[model samples]
Target: MTTVRGTIRSTNTIPADGHGDDQSTARARAVDGLELTGYDVVQTNTLSSTAAGNITVRAVARSTEIQPHEASGPNYGAARAAYLQTIPDGWISLGITVNA
Candidate 1:
């Protein structure tokens, strides 16, 4: 079994109406970065605040793959690359964890 569970905290400057979609897009990119395409979403949460015309958003996404075969381990290198490639501007990863 392989499991990837962690919180991705990020600060962004976005408008209120665009916050939701942007957050969702960020979460999806992070998930794709982890290479958990077929995994289940354990939990997802986001919190946002606005100040000085900038909105800071914190997104946490948890995912898991149960009883995966040998080929199912997380590709950390690729994941990192994907994260770097997909993450939106001004968004950063606070932390992450992976268990297999």
Candidate 2:
């Protein structure tokens, strides 16, 4: 199986009326180095910090990762399309890195 890593954080902003964004304030929380072994999440190391006192969080849209196949098909395009449909609405990638 192949593994990948990404960081996830909330984009929600918590407005504080009485609180402040001073040195003691916690603005944002992120899970860095979150490893994904296929569809299974293996690691979730947390990293917390703030930027510009705005609870800034950086992220990308959903991503797709195609698993490795052990079987061969005559028409890869047709088979791939049909197989891709089985995946629910989410990330859908086309290829992978094979290590020999």
Candidate 3:
């Protein structure tokens, strides 16, 4: 089994109207997408700051077959490719951890 834990941090400027619901929705969609790709999400931690217009989401996902890899030089190319394809646009991968 392999465990992949990571913090995905993003900052979006709140509109003048202060409608940040869309940002929240986007974050949810990103997590959902990961689940759809066959990872089981074990835990999630979210933090948002209205004053700073910043949002940080941390999720831990586990998979029996998939292995984690370093972003600089990924040993599991297919896993990395799947992750890249799964993540929604506009969301950045801030950090990742893999445990076997």
Q: Candidate 3 on 1-100: residue-level lDDT in tens?
A: 3444454433221211112344565356446545434445655555554555555454555542333333322345554555555555444566666654
TM-score of each: 0.28, 0.28, 0.30
lDDT of 1 at 12: 26
lDDT of 2 by residue, 6-67 (tens): 22222222221112244333222222222223333222222233564533333222223443
Q: After superposition, how far is residue 79 of candidate 1 from its true place, in Å?
A: 1.9
Q: Which of 2 and 3 is ahead in lDDT? A: 3
Q: Please give the CA lDDT of all the candidate structures.
A: 0.41, 0.31, 0.46
Candidate 1 lDDT, 8-99, residue by residue in tens: 43342221122333556645544444433443444444455344333333333333322211112357655555445554554455554555
Q: What is the lDDT of residue 11 in candidate 1?
A: 45
Of the pair 1 and 3, which is ahead by lDDT? Answer: 3
TM-score of model number 2: 0.28
Residue 22: error of model 2 in Å? 3.6
Off by over 4 Å in 3: 1-4, 15-75
Query: Worst lDDT window (10 residues) for model 1?
Result: 64-73
- Show model 1 residue runs off by greater than 4 Å: 1-5, 13-74
